[model samples]
Target: MSAPDVVFVTGNANKLKEVKMILASESSKINLINEPLDLEEIQDVDLQSIALAKCKQASKLLGPGRPVFVEDTALCFDSFNGLPGAYIKWFVKSMGLAGIVQMLSGFENKGAEAITTLTYTDGEGHFHTFQGVTHGTIVTSRGPTDFGWDSIFQPDESHGQTYAEMDKAAKNAISHRGRAFAEFKAFIATEFK
Candidate 1:
């Protein structure tokens, strides 16, 4: 049987590409794509809640009978006690890469976690949330990639290489977005089987 058509709503082209790759690697029956829909993203401390709210809002905006999904990624720092939990996007934008390093300079414990939350809708408005998390520590910003806050964050399983330092394949193998997409792909495969 053919899987349900999935529309991913996101503004990040890098993320969209990565999601396509992850889903494509999972099964042959699924089609992956995205639509640029400007939906209100509520400022919530919880990544899941934010993604879910966006999913619901997108469903209402796009009307019914469209299986759409929204993804939200955040980098939460333990030192700040989640001060920038879901607001990591804003933080990165306002602070820049060097500023992030400065933000952690005073704290002895620079632990952080990368979180990716995905909310899927079954066209009629049913929402399913899938999450992925990678524990790591904040390092001095490095690498040439322009994607988000990747330069400063190093995953525990990355062998000391930051996300920006790794290629697409390496990053996908252990990234929060990748893990979340992994679950998302599995869910689609089973549900549509």
Candidate 2:
């Protein structure tokens, strides 16, 4: 059987890489295509709402009978009660790795969570969102801080390595985005296949 096509809307090449990798296992059943769309990413605290909005916007562009998928991720700091929860992108841009460490320097409890919400639809006007969160601590910089707060976030399931430290497969094994996409893969295998 030929692979069914699905449009994945995202400008970030890294995201496309990860999503493609995740869907690779199911590639025989699903053919994923990248479509870069600069949709208005709402800064609302509700992750689901933000994901749903983006999914709807992207799906609208694709019109009817076309499947579209979109994802939104956030880094939530317990020290700040998830402040800048859904705004991690801007926060990371403004505050570098050093700034993040300094901000949590005084706090004894450095609890944090990495949340990823994946919203997808078959252009049936029924958008569905799947979320995954990794519970970890806000530790001092351990590895390269090249990507977002990866250096500072040490997932409890990832041994002692931060997201930035682990390679693509290793990180995806225990990442918020990976977990969410795992669910997405299962969904696609069943629904679109």
Candidate 3:
């Protein structure tokens, strides 16, 4: 097998797929093991800490000798003073994208930001951290191709299109995950390759 020092641990399949795709070209020399790590989710006020917690859990589950990576993203709307930053997932499920749009319809300001924090741990227990942020605005209307909250959230100066409106390749090129994983890939290249 290729260099067996890389493992991506996540339970979100869609997120995992996108991440693997992003890393594929850069990680050809390494064995990219994809596995869902079982970890209990706890209440936290920040994305960095949550990602680290997940990474730690995965490393421990992997028996102290396997490297694992984890990522968590939070959507912060300036209009809401980042009300749903760390609680994005919960809010999305409870309020849905449409509800969020409706809730923000009256506000003149639609500014927002998406933040992703990534945490990685080598089998030796050494850790690495990275973060990426994309600033945007909340659109009053949903887009046709957008999934999740992408339909209702528009990036700043994005030439007028929601993330869901962009093609996968285009979205990947400028997404929060993409930005963060770019740093992550670089880290792996420098450290593992």
The best candidate in terms of lDDT: 2
* Better TM-score candidate (1, 3): 1
True-structure lDDT of candidate 3: 0.79
What stretches of model 2 exceed 4 Å from their correct place?
none
- Estimate, for each residue in 64-174, the C-alpha lDDT of model 1 and write its tens digit: 998889988888889988768888878888988788878989899999989999999889757899999999989987786488888898899999989999888899989
Q: Write the per-residue lDDT of candidate 3 for residues 74-180, one digit (tens) a residue.
A: 88878888868878777778987778777777778778898889998877978989998888988755566324577877777467788878776777788888899
Q: Which residue pairs in candidate 1 have backbone atoms (N, alpha carbon, C) closer than 3 angstroms, thus clashing?
A: none
What is every candidate's alpha-carbon RMSD to the true fold? 1.4, 1.3, 1.9
Question: All candidates' TM-scores?
Answer: 0.94, 0.94, 0.91
Flag regions of model 3 displaced more than 4 Å: 144-146
lDDT of all predictions? 0.84, 0.86, 0.79
TM-score, candidate number 1: 0.94
Candidate 1 regions off by >4 Å?
1-3
Which is superior by lDDT, 1 or 3? Answer: 1
